[model samples]
Target: MKKLLYFEQDSSRIRPIVVALSKHFEVSVAGDLLELAATLRQKEPRILLFGLASLPGAFSIHILDRIKQIMLNLHEEKLASRSALSVVVMHGDDSRWQQICEPYIAALREIPFCDIYVIPAATNPDELAVSIINIKRANRHLRTARMSATAEVPIIGNSTKMRHVIEQIRTYADKHHPVLIVGETGTGKELAARALHFWGKRSHHHFVALNCATIPETLFESEMFGTERGAYTDASTRMGAIEQADNGTLFLDEIGSLSLASQPRLLRVLETGEYRRLGDPHPHSAQFRLVSASCINPIDLAAKNKFRSDLVYRIADLVIEIPPLRHRAEDIPLLAAHFCSHFSKDAFSLEQNALDKLCAYHWPGNVRELRSVIARACANNSTGRIFADDIQFLYQWKFEGNSQPEVSA
Candidate 1:
């Protein structure tokens, strides 16, 4: 169960709510900074709730610094648990609490808090319990994305290659430089882009995405650079993906598919962090971290005149390569088990023969193919064990080197 360390000025008013939440959370009460420090020293709760209506009489900058220091110390010592613990403040009314925390709100917000939101004044116990549970789960997912990269990102693989991928994500999550994610189709390139955005400083802002492959070449200007009222025949004032993603991240997928015409706009933003909306000559400023993905090596595309070399160099300050599933076949069983547990409504397990069959076939489509196989078995077979006969490889395609060969089962 997740734990909560709560601090309140008057213990009497919040005591009842505490008792009700004790059933769901391991709850501990702290009346003052001294007690709060004692509690922090003794235990590492997943969430810390500052449930006070007003600031404590003993509040001071020194005390505040100490609290942050202790939390940081705990984080370093428990690297695995760092992503799980969160600090949040809850209150029913904002007026008093706002006044109380206005000075320190900026400093607290500067801390990597999972969230800061409103709540009932210790009144609705049931609703708060559910909310707490939901918040805990959501934070855990984000934390998983940050710490394990692929493990918690819902990507479901634990190979040595995958661990390095996760490490790269954590490394680039904080920087402002553009990132290029290179991988084969179905290699979860977009998923890694999301991890970079959400686990980074830009997470609190918007995450705008544009898939160049799906977008028409004619609409690149309007879709990426924004437009103003009367900019076109019927265009109203609008912000494009770059403007919308200001102060956040803009992920461009299949970036190698971008024509030379659209590459200028992308290169302009990376070079100057500036762009003008269509019809409106007034250049609007947009500051965003750029993350681009492609199935092919973008530089190679540039060399072939399919992409601009200058643009390719600008977008690829850090390149992350996602290995194909066939290379990391060791993760197949774990990935298969993860999918079965997720898609199966009933209790389920895969037989040894079934597992062998899954591991034997080459997954040209990677984890995505594995998920489909498991999902199909769960839908067609009984709730019990699924044998080799029950598991089927519907697709007759497999990869051998760069060429795909057809094989009869």
Candidate 2:
């Protein structure tokens, strides 16, 4: 377990947070400023939790000045080498606590921590675990720089196009900008979205994916922003995907299907980080990273007024396009063998004929279609090796009334 240095004086009140975090990290609690400094020296914990709620009641400029001096002194003392420290300042969510903590947040910003998180006292534990794990992964990556030869891509495939996709995922992981993935259906758009979320800074929170096309426009707003009890006939209190994905990622799939009527609503939340539940007059704040995917050309759709141009601009901060499987035929053999192994009972191999057929096939359904074909082929093949005949004859059924075009073998 990773070490966590928690600096909270009133452990009785925030015991739940400590308990929750203990499930993930080895929590070392410090009761006061002096104990905090002692724990920092003894534990050398990279991940620190600041108990800003326990700040001095006196609230003197002198007290603030003394705190700043201590922080600055630590900076100078640790300046000789880089520290692997990450900090989180937790505060209550109510009005008065927000007012009190805002200045302290600004004050801590002046100190040089690798990253600073201003977390709410009421944050969901599962989501908090995501944040903790993200930081832990990053820290491990940083420490393993010496083992450079062992570096690897979390996503599969060695094709040039896939490599480009991987590179884009890596580049955008650290940034808070919204990402838009464009590709044909079955081209692993959601998989790529997962790569972005799990490998990024916000990897510690929930990655919520909603398919706009699958959901009706009548319920789109309610689905995206949630609904309150009695808001509609038989409506019960519920949190929307956006609110649930707070400080995490919200992946909107088939983004082209987002209705124009609901587009402005999405735009408002993305711009202001605030949304109102159905029948609720007051707006609630939710800060989440937006990652959207579309099979159609959003730019072209915007030109035709099918998609909201402003919403497109807000969500497409970084865009990645995955090429169709046909365009990356070199990866087909590797992908085919992978799927074949997934279905086969014994050690698996793909015959050259099967690979040739796969490469020659018109992949209308892209990667997903290919996987299904390989899976079906393996189930039919008693022999450990997959041959061309075992593969799905996707074409040649015209007289039987298959809609797809017939092609010569």
Candidate 3:
């Protein structure tokens, strides 16, 4: 188990935090600064917690100077390198404590430590845990030279268009910018979004997805901003998807369908990192990365005033456009084989005739249509191997005049 060494003058407050963190870590308690420092040297704990009062007696410049000297001297010690150390300072009731701690805190900040958090005496343990974890993760990421996670695009195809898309995905996977995926309906927009999220820094947090088109217009506010108890006809206190996805990625799909009235509310949250729950006077906020996708051309919709231009700008920080299946014809065989294997109970191989038929067909419904066709063909075939006759009828489907000539079975 992970180790935590906590030093707090208030034994009452420490009990709750210790209980909560102990579920995931091995926790130890220290009542005073001297004991805490000795425990630190011996145990080398992962995290350290201290109350503002724990900074040794006598609140004078001399005392502050002594603390600074000790911290500076410790920075020179090679023994401090092994563990990820974080210090949390819980301010006491004395107003004078802040004045004396400010300069010392600034000096401590310059020293190389994982992180330093200042929280109210009344702060909840869950919020404390969230802040600690985020800082821990941020520190780990900064220390690494390359991405700690190897993000790979699972789809395979040799087509020029497919190759370009994969390259673009690789380029944007590790970036911090918001990503907007654009494509025709059923073009695997969600797949692209998940690939980016899993490859990015926020992968450890929840990947909460909300479909704007799927939600009703009346409930959009409640769904996005949780309601407070006694706020509305049937309101109950709850956390919204935004808070649930705090420090993680929130995937908003078909965002164009969101009402214009709801757009400004979303814009406010993105701008200020704050939002008032429905019927709640106080505003709560969280740090969440946004990833949105739309099937329609967002630019065209914004021009027509059907979609908010401001919202579009916020969500489209880094846009990725996915080509329709008809445009990336070479990918048809690859996608077909993937889906056939997905639908078959046992290992199944696609005949060359079926692949030729798939390439010849005009994919009106894009990737979704291909998946459906492959599923139907796999379920109907009694044999494990798929034959040309199984998928030959796809060539007879009506194609746009610009479509490539049909390849014969």
| Candidate 3: tens digits of C-alpha lDDT, residues 189-260 | 887877776766555454678999988877877788766656888665555677556656788999988888
Please give, for residues 37-146, the per-residue lDDT of candidate 2 as tens digits: 77776777768876555444234223334545656666777841365466766554354654454465456545644345554453455545555565566446534531
RMSD of each: 12.3, 7.8, 8.5
- Measured against the true structure, the TM-scores of the candidates, in listed sequence, are 0.62, 0.66, 0.66
Q: What are the runs in model 3 whose C-alpha is more than 4 Å off?
A: 1-153, 229-236, 392-409
Q: Rank the candidates by lDDT, best first.
A: 2, 1, 3
Ranking by TM-score: 2, 3, 1
Q: Worst 10-residue stretch by lDDT in candidate 2?
A: 145-154
Give the residue spans of candidate 2 off by over 4 A: 1-154, 399-409
Task: Look at candidate 2 and tell me the lDDT of residue 168.
Answer: 93
lDDT of 2 at 289: 83
How does each model score on lDDT?
0.72, 0.73, 0.70
Better of 1 and 2 by lDDT: 2
What would you estimate as the lDDT of candidate 1?
A: 0.72
lDDT of 3 at 145: 15
